[model samples]
Target chain A: MFAQSLVGAAAAVAAHLETLLAEHQALPVVEAMGYATRGGKALRGYLVLESARLHGVPEGHAIWPACAIEAVHAYSLVHDDLPCMDDDDLRRGLPTVHRKWDEATAVLAGDALQALGFELVSDPRCHPSGEVRADLALSLARAAGARGMVMGQALDMAAEATDVPLDLAQITALQAGKTGALIRWSAEAGARLAEVDPAPLTAYADRLGLAFQIADDILDVEGDAAMMGKAVGKDAGRGKATFVSLLGLDTAKLRARQLVDEACDALSPYADRAENLRAAARFVISRSN
Target chain B: MFAQSLVGAAAAVAAHLETLLAEHQALPVVEAMGYATRGGKALRGYLVLESARLHGVPEGHAIWPACAIEAVHAYSLVHDDLPCMDDDDLRRGLPTVHRKWDEATAVLAGDALQALGFELVSDPRCHPSGEVRADLALSLARAAGARGMVMGQALDMAAEATDVPLDLAQITALQAGKTGALIRWSAEAGARLAEVDPAPLTAYADRLGLAFQIADDILDVEGDAAMMGKAVGKDAGRGKATFVSLLGLDTAKLRARQLVDEACDALSPYADRAENLRAAARFVISRSN
Candidate 1:
């Protein structure tokens, strides 16, 4: 049921956003943007749908903001692959944008995507009022900009240690910047689409984001490159510390279970409304990628 | 009187947006952000005020949106100065952000400014509805992003030859893209803030933006590099075409007067209400930088 809903949300966003990109941006840039978008696993998007379903958000009504969330996620991936940042040559079995085009074009394309995301998400008709949409857009951007994503990058760059041994809290905070922030944003945006109080959803997101990162660490250690469809063991190679690096593999798995359990407990108040999210948490640790 | 109103709008935006930036983004980034923003003539901010004043928009109601327009204009200048774009070394007499910080930092700073702009512009109490604020915010982003400002840069890059004369229509099209688009968006957003129609003001903006660009071209030809604080003779140096290059100095000044006359004529219906704008058009030709 959760998988079906996830697929539904992703499809709706892809279809609607194609029209948006074509209409609002230049044609060549739009085509390149579409290529960057098609490479994602739709994991973050699925979380949005599953969270909204758990909260009883109408899919049709949620489509607009959902598109925005997906666009932001896509843009992050695109920018993360740039030469000045990650310098990654390939991603998810495709040539990364920096490799496909020059670095400058990729930069402009990614920048446009980020702006486009906020623009789409802030469309007021999707929310209860223009004020609510404005607030949501502010929250989303705050998460993605200097206070959130940029801060995370700056931390990673400024880390004095060659292999920083981050404690659980530090790891969580870093991932919150690197990955968790966007994950939480997607879920929160979904709840906003339903016009629900975001306190419980935020708690759910806090645990969910860490579990996703822990699972990523585990997969990097255990999963084969072919199964991952991207680099495995690349994190360890870079001396980029991970949860598994901080904790032994056995302990890291234990920590993942603990985080997922806490996440499930957070959602228990909603009963079956959160079943798909519970399943998603289980999927996070168990999947190869 | 026009200068005072323009400065009022710019100062109001600078003061309020500083708080928003400090609270959301880090103090350091905001400080650096402040550094980049403090350097402009606040021309965009002035346009918002002049139009607002022309339409009899109350001073209190005018304060919020005018600030929003300035933030957007500041963001465009930051991004446009990126080495990948204009490769501008100085902006408003200070080293460009990309030069002061890393290229990546400049990129993120630009992103932060754009987010900051939307947040300020979309503040709920400032507008009647979330939809209205969203429309205004989106219009600003559309002007700043690929199909508008970015596209203009791309076109300018491809143009290459400064000596080749661009015909009247081509010159107008380029000016509309590079200089006029954002100016036009500013008028429309201010009109929205007043809950007034932007149609009548289109003629005013159409002429206002051209006169602005023509003045810029004239400055490029006759102005001193030390005072302008940017690379001079670039139009002739790189062979990028301009109105003065195509029409020669005499005809270019004549055309500028024609545009200014048409712009003021468009405001004839407003009379004393448009006095500030009439003063602004007169001031444009006399600006040294």
Candidate 2:
């Protein structure tokens, strides 16, 4: 049931993104942007849509923030794949933006996509209230800026300079800013859009984000590169620090299960209305890709 | 006289940016953003503040957009100077961000600064009305996105691949997006803040932006590297087409003068209240660097 809902949310957000980008002139940057945003699972968008549904926010109002998060996520991937960054050639079984076009196009496409994300959230059509739009933009900036995703990227780059691998606590802190920050923001977006207290959802997100990372680490160790659509076991190959490196494989799996349970428990106040969110938590740990 | 006001605006915006960025954790990316935003003319910020003054907007409300434009301008420069891009070593008499830090930090810093620009424009303290903030953010996104600055950058990159230099008309159209879009947006920001018609300032910006590029071309032909803090005559050396190359040095200067006259004439409705803006038009063509 959760899988079906997620797929539906992904399709809706994808269509919305396609339409929004269509309005832009048919420049190479625009073409690269469309190419870059495609083929992702759209998990972030799904989280946003589901959370909004849980709170009874209309789909019309909810789709903007959902597309906004997915745009940001796609941009992060585009930049992260740049040669100066991770230097990856493939993502989702396709050439990365830089590989498909060039480095300049990749950089500009990612930058423009980030701007588009802010534009979507700030559009009046996204919500009737200006305050809500401003709040959404502000929170997004926090999640994606120096205190959030960029911070994690910076730390990751800096870590590559030192021979010493990060300890478990250090890796956790780094991941919290990098991957975990966006996930938490995605989970809490519905509450922000609905103008409700986000504490419950935020609690759920805190656990789910960490669990998601653990699953990613597990996948890196055991998952197939063909299925993942990119290289796997890269951390282990590079002697880089990761959860699986700190904790044994069995122990890491156990921790992810525990985290999923805690994430589900945090959603108890919403009762069965949050069943999809609960299932999402479980899905994070079990997904093959 | 206009130069002094511009200097003062630069100082005020710099101080505000320092304070705003100071709140973030003292990470390398934050430090790079501060470094990137400093030491330029801050002409864009001056345009925002002066335009707001012409429209009788308060300084408190005006500073947010003023700083926002400057931040965006700084981010563009930082990215444009990356090794994969323009590959510059100096800017504003200091090492470029990529030169001072590593390439990764430069990329992350530029990305974060862009987010900071959106954050400032969307903050509630910038305005009481959410609609006003959203409008500012939306307009800014358009100016800075694929349809605007990014579009120009993409064109400029594509132009490099062709053996033939861009013709005058092509170069003009390219400059309109690369530099003119932001200038036009900055000039009209006050009217947006006042929620009044932006026609007069928009007219002024249209001419002023073209004139500013002409002046840059003139400077590239004759200015000292010490004052400009960047290599001059590179366009000529590379045989790249420019206003100076197409129109010749003397003709470019005359054209810039003509544009300044038209830009100042556009401000006739504001009369004495627009003295600073008129001086700005004159200053754009006269400054050596």
TM-score of each: 0.89, 0.96
For model 1 the local lDDT of residue B23 reads 73
Off-target runs (Cα >4 Å) in candidate 1 are: A24-26, A124-133, A160-168, A220-235, B24-28, B53-63, B128-133, B157-171
TM-score of chain A of 1: 0.91
In candidate 2, position A41 carries an lDDT of 82
lDDT of 1: 0.71
Q: After aligning candidate 1 to the native by TM-score, how far in Å is the CA of B71 from where it should be?
A: 2.9
Which consecutive 10 residues in model 2 chain B have the weakest lDDT in total? B124-133
Alpha carbon lDDT of residue A245, candidate 2?
88
Model 1 earns a TM-score of: 0.89
What is the fnat of candidate 1? 0.30
lDDT, candidate 1, at A260:
82
Candidate 1 residue-wise lDDT, B1-289, digit = tens? 7778767767776776666666753534455667777756777777776677666666555556666667666766776787766789987777888788766666666666666666666666456443434666666667666666655654565454344556778778767877787788766666766667787577888788899888888888898778988777777676667888788888888888888888878878777787777777777766623
